[model samples]
Target: MKSISRATIGLTSSVSVLGVVLLAVLVYCCIHFWQAKQQEETANRALHAVEHLLLKPTSEYSPEDVKHGLEEVLGGQGRTQARVVDSRGNRMFGPEVFFNGEGSIREFSQVFETELPQLQAKRVELAVSTVDDERFLNFISGIFASSIVLWILVSVLISMRLIRLVLRPINRLTERIHNLGPRSLDVVLDDHKAPLELRPFIDGFNRLLGQLRENREQLKLFNSNVAHELNTPLSSLTISHELLQRRKLIEGEDLQKIVGDHLDELDRMARIIRSMLFLANANQGRKLQLQPVPSLRQLVVSVAEYLEQLAEDRDLRITVKSDATVEAETELIKRAVSNLLSNAIRYAQANTEITVHITLEAERVWIKVSNEGPTIDPLKLNRLFEPFFRAEEGRSDTGSNHGLGLAIVAAIAKLHGGDVFASSENQVTVIGFSIQTKRQSASG
Candidate 1:
C-alpha cells in the first residue's frame, strides 16, 4: 500500500540536474581564471621589455636626446602619448596633450610661474588604457543569459525523461489494481519488462495476493462441502432414531443394528473433519521437517500388513518389490501408499489381483500400486489428484469417501519433492510414487 509522491520524484530529478550544471560551471570558472592569469603575466613581461630597451644609457646621448628617444619609443609602441614639461608646467617637447576631464580640480594662481616638480608630472603621462566599453559588457552578459536559458531547458528535459522512466511501471500497476476485483489471482507480472530493482517487490505482492485469493475460495468450498457431507449422515441418524422411537420392539438385534449404523455415520463425520483440518494446515504452509527415512522395502511390507484385511475381503493380492531403501518419513509415505491402495481397491473388480511393488533403479525409488481394474478414462486421469474430484458417481456411492485422500497424498508428495502419476494400459491401471536416492560418496 506504500506509494511515492509525484512531487518528490520531480524534485529529486531537478536537484540531480542542478548538481551537474553547477559542476560544469565550476570547470568553466577554473579555465577562465587560468587564462586571465596567463594573459596578465604576458602583458607585464612585454611592458618591462619595452621600458628596458628604450632607457639603456649610451655615451653619445644627452639628457634631452634620451627623453626624445623614450618619447619616440612610446609613440612607436602606441604606449601612451608622451611629452616633456618645463618648470612652468608647460609643454617643452613632443606633441601637445590635454587633460579633458578633471576630478577634484585644484585652484591655481594663473598658470604656474614655477610649478612644484610633482605638478609638472602631468606632461609626462604614458599610455592611457582605453576605457572598457559598456556595449562589450552587455554582450558578455548576453552569453551568460543564454547559458542560463539552456540550463533550464536541459534540466526540464532530464526531469521529464526520469519521470517517464519511473512512472510508467507504477502506472501499469495502478491500472492493474483498478482492474482487479477479488479475482486477480491469475494475473502474472512480466518480470522481463519490469525494472530490476522493483522486480522483487512486484513478485512478492503478486504472490501474497494470489495466496489470499486462493484461501478465500478454498474456505468457501470447504464450508459448502462439509455441510453437504455431514447433512446426509445426520439425516440418516435422525430417521433411524425416529423409527426406533415409533416402534415398540426396540430391545432386539434390529435395534442394535440401527445404533451401529448411527455410530458409523458419526465416524465418517470425524474422518472428514480430520482431513479438512490437515488440508487447512497444509494450505497455510505448515512445514514438516524431515530426517532420513526407513528402507522402502520395509515401509511397503508394513503397509501391506496394515491393509491386509481389506485386500482379503475383496480377494485382492498385495505385493511389494524393492531393491533399495527410500529416504522418506515413515508415517507420510505410509499415508500416501495407503491412499493409492484405497483408491485402487475402490475401482478394482471383485476377486481381482492388486499388486503393490517397490523398486530401486537408476538412483530412484519407485513404489507402484497397480490393480486389475477397467482402464481409467484418459481425460479424467490428470484431475484425479485434485481435491473433491471423484472419478464417477458409481465409484463413490458405497465407499462414501469425502474425496480428500488422494489430495492429501499429492500434498505430501510435493512436500517431499516427489510426484505421483496414474497411467493405464490393457484394462489395468497403475498409480505410483518416486523419490530421489541419496547420492553415493567417493569413498563408497
Candidate 2:
C-alpha cells in the first residue's frame, strides 16, 4: 500500500499544478494588457509628432521634409515604419514600409488635406512592430516557468515534512500497539494529550483496549466457573462409581437408586454443556427461525403454567397480564420467557404474587416479570445478564440454577433485535426483554 505521505504529496502536486496554470494565465493576461497599452501609447506619440509636422505650413516643408521629420519622431529603432502617400494610392515620401521578421504589427493611418491645393490629400500610415514586446514576454514567461518549477519542488519538500509531522502521532500509536501483548491489555492511550485530529482514533483504540481487557477478565472468570460447576457433579459420579466397583455385593433397590443418582448427575452435566454451546452459538450471531406469534400474552401464560409447580413450591402465584403480537423465534422466545419466570419464582417471597406484564408498543412488545424479593444490589444488577454471573442470593440450593438463565435470555433478546433489562427496587425485581412486533420486524 502507498504511504500517506506519498498520497498527500501527490494531492499537493495536483493542486500546485492547477495553481501554476491559473497564475500563468493571469500573468499572460497582464502582459498582453501591458503590450496593448504600450502599442496605444506608441500610436499616440507618432500621431502627435505627425500633427506637429503638419503645423508647419505645407509650403514650408516638402514631402521629403515631412518624411524626415516623421522618421526622427518615430526613431530608427527598426521597429516602426511610416510613409506618406497621396490619396491616389501613390507613395509621396518615406522608405517602402515592409517587414520580414515574424512578429505582430499595428497600423495607424491619418488622412489630411494640405494647404497646397495642387497637392492631393496625403495620408500618413505608421506600422509599429511588436517583436521587442514578444522578446520581453518570452523572457518573463521563462522566469515564471522557472519560478513555478521551483515552487513545485519547494511545495513537495514542505508537504512531505508537514505530512510527517501530521503522522507522527499515528506512528507513535502504532509503535505502542506493536509493543502491546495480551498481558498488557490494561494499558490505555491518552486521548487528551493527542492532537484534536487524532483524538477520535485514540479514543476508539482506547475503548477497544478496554473491551479486550474486560473480555479477558470475563474469560478467566468463566473458565474458573465452568471448572467448578463441572467438577462437583463429576466428583460425585466418580465416587458413586468407585463405591459400586468396590462393593462385594449390593441389594437390587440400592443399586437402582445409585444408578438413578448417576443418571441425574450426568443429566446436569449435559445441561451445562448444552447451555454453554447455546451461548457460544448465540454470541456468534446464529440465525433464528422466526414466525409470527398472534398472542404474546398467551405464550407467557403457557411458560408460566409450565413452571407453575416450581412457583407453587415457593408458595408464589404466577399471573400474566396484557397482550401483544410479535414476530419471533417461538422456541427461543419461550425459553427466554421461561427463564425470566423461573428466575422470578426462585426469588419471589412466599405467598407473593409474581406478575408477567406484556406491553404492546408501536414497534416492540415488552415482557416484564416482577416479583417481590430481596432487592438486587444496584451495582451488580446490570451484570446479572452476563453468563456465569450471579448475586450471592442467586446461588441456588438445588444446584440446578447455573447462572446462565439470564444470559440466555439476553442472547435471545438480541436475536430478536432487542435487549434484556433488569431493575430491582423496593423489594421488587423486574426482569424482562423486548422483541420487535411484526410490522417493525418486517420493516427492519
Candidate 3:
C-alpha cells in the first residue's frame, strides 16, 4: 500500500481549514461591498436627475414638469422612491414616505437651492430608497464561489510542494533502513545532515543497531557452545558402541559398566536439551499457569529436600527460614526453587550452612539463598545469571554443573513478573529473586 508522509497530512489538513476560513471572510466582505455599491449607484442616479431638472431654464420647464421627471426616474423601480421639498420644508413633489414596516429600509436624502434667471430661487430636498439586494446577493455569491475554487486549487498545489520539501530527508532515511541488514552494523546515519526533528530518532536507531549486532555475536557463541556440549557426549557414546561391536564375545560386569556409562552421557545430554527448551519457552513470553500456593516456606522445603543429598555430599547443611505464601505456577516455581538449591549446594563451603530466606511483602515474595564461600568478584557477579556463564570463583565441576541452573532461575523469575539479583561480600554470597503474588499479577 502507498503511504503518505506526516508532513503531507499535516499541511493538507491545515490548508483545508485555512481555505474554509478565508472563503467565509471573503464571501462576507463581497456581500457587504456589493450591497453598498448598489445603494450608492441608485442614490447618485436620483440626485443627478434632480440637478438636471433644476438646471433647465424656468421658461423651458416649470416646477410641475421637473416634479414629473423625478417621478419617472425613481418610481419606475418598485424598491426606490424619491421626494422633493422646498426651502420652507413644505412638500413640493412626490408622495410622503415613512418607514412603518417590520423589515429594514435604506434611504438617502439631500437638500439644495437652485436659482433661475426668470424665476425666484427655490430650494429642494431630495430623497430616494434603494434597499432591494437580490441581484447584489446573487453577484456576490458567484464571485465568492469562484474565489473559493481558485483558493482550493492554489492551496493544493502549494501544499504538495511544501510537503515534498519537508519529507525529502525522511524518504532518504527510509531508503537507508530498507538497505540495512546484520552485516551492515557499521553503517551510521548522518545526524548533522538530517533534519533537527529526526536527529534523536536517528541516534536511537543507531543504538538499536549496535545492540542487535551484539546479540547476533552472542547467539553465534551460544550455538557453538551448544554444539560442542552435545558433541562430547555423542562422541563418548559412539566410542562405547564401537567397542561393544568389536568385542561381541565379551559379557558380565564390564559390559554393564559400559552400558551405565552410556546412560550417564545420555542423561547429561537430556538435561542440557531440557534446560534449552525451558529457556526458549521463557523467551517467547508464554503465559504461566499462575495460582496461589499455600506456603512459600513449604515450596522451599520441598526443593531443599530434593537437593539434601547433594548438599550433604558437599558437607553442607540446608536450612530454610520462610513463613510466607506466594502465587506462582506450581511446576515452574518448583523448578526455579530446585535450581537455586542445587546451585547453592554446588558452591557452598564444606560444613557451611546454606540458608533459604523468604521475605514476603504486600505484593510479592522474595526467596534468597545465602552461603559462605570465597567472595565472588563484583564485576563477574553481573554475568552470573547469563546462560553458560560460570564464574571462576564459584563451583568448577564441569561434569555436573552445566552453567544453566542460574539462567533457568532467572527466566522463571522474569516469567513471574520479577527479576534476579546477586551480591557477594565479607566471604558470603547471596543469590535469589522475587515473584509477584497473584494480586500484583492481576493488577499488572
- Estimate, for each residue in 328-398, the C-alpha lDDT of model 2 and write its tens digit: 89999999998998888877899999998887666777889999999989999989998888876545653
Top-down lDDT ranking? 2, 3, 1
For 300-337, candidate 3 gives per-residue lDDT tens digits of: 88888888888888889888874676678989888888
Among these predicted structures, which one has the highest lDDT? 2
lDDT string, candidate 1, 1-444, tens digits: 434545655576578657756766775666556644554554455445434433444545555555655565445233233344555577654455323332221111112221232223233323332323233345555666687668767766776777787888888877876887766667766677877877897888888887887778867876776787888788898898788778878777887898889889999888888887877787676677555654566676787788889888888877765445555666887888888888887788888888877665576666788988788788888877777777775535633577888888877776666677789878899888766658311110
User: Candidate 1: minimum summed lDDT over ten consecutive residues — where?
Assistant: 102-111
Name the candidate that leads on TM-score: 2
Candidate order, TM-score descending: 2, 3, 1
The lDDT of each candidate is 0.66, 0.82, 0.77
Model 2 stretches with alpha carbons more than 4 Å out: 51-78, 99-104, 111-115, 393-395, 438-444
- The total of clashing pairs for model 1 equals 3
Clashes of 2: 0
User: What value of lDDT does candidate 3 attain over all alpha carbons?
Assistant: 0.77
Question: What's each prediction's TM-score?
Answer: 0.67, 0.90, 0.76
